[model samples]
Target: MKHLSDNEKDTSRIAAALAEDLQPGNVLLLHGTLGMGKTVFARALIRALTGRPDIDVPSPTFTLVQTYDGLICPIYHYDLYRIEHPEEIFELGWDDALADGITIVEWPDRLGSYKPRLSLDITLSNADNDPNKREILIETNA
Candidate 1:
């Protein structure tokens, strides 16, 4: 699916829609450069899944990963930006999340050859002429 987000509200709306269909083993690979709406979309999806519109969804930048329970399924949000090696994920107990929760990864290129069996790849890019506007694309690979 391709979505045009004129503003953050539209992006969040799209995230909420996508969040509705997530399953336990779902892995979402989020790709975007700095200042893109990657974290914004992830936060919206996490909030939707938690059924808490007011929930505090912090970016997993420094912490590397964060988990939320009590949702339809657990969500493991990962920010791989600081990871210098894919093996670093193992140190973070990544297998635990991969086995039992839906995982959303940012800067997934850091994963190198360690790709998931199936995943939804979402990419965000600035729309022409508007820095705040973005073009988002979501695709699944089997």
Candidate 2:
């Protein structure tokens, strides 16, 4: 699937749609460069899943992982950008999240060989030289 986000609100809308369809054990790999709207999409998604517009979904960049409960299933949002090795995933409760919730990963390249075999990967990039407009491509392995 392909989408164009003309503005931040459009990003939230796309995130809402995806969040609604996500289920336990589902993994979403988000790929984008810095300032390319990955966190914006993720924060909106977490809020939609919890049915709370004010949910404090902070970027897990430094902490590496952040989780939110109280939804149909939990959501584990991970920022593997800081990880120096794939084994760090295990230390972050990777196995538990895989079994019980949705995992949304940022900078998933760090996962190396441990990346999920089946996942929905989303790529966001600046479109038409417009910083606010994002071209998004979605690929799925079902």
Give the per-residue Cα lDDT of candidate 1 at 126.
89
Off by over 4 Å in 2: none
Clashes of each: 0, 0
- Residues 1-142 of candidate 1 have per-residue lDDT tens digits of 8989999999999999999889888899999998798889999999998899998988999999989983767889999999998999988767887787889999999988886868999999989779779999999994
lDDT of 2 by residue, 61-107 (tens): 89999998948888899999899999999999899889988898999
- Local distance difference test, per candidate? 0.89, 0.92
Clashing pairs in 2: none
Worst 10 residues of 2 by lDDT: 67-76
TM-score of each: 0.96, 0.97
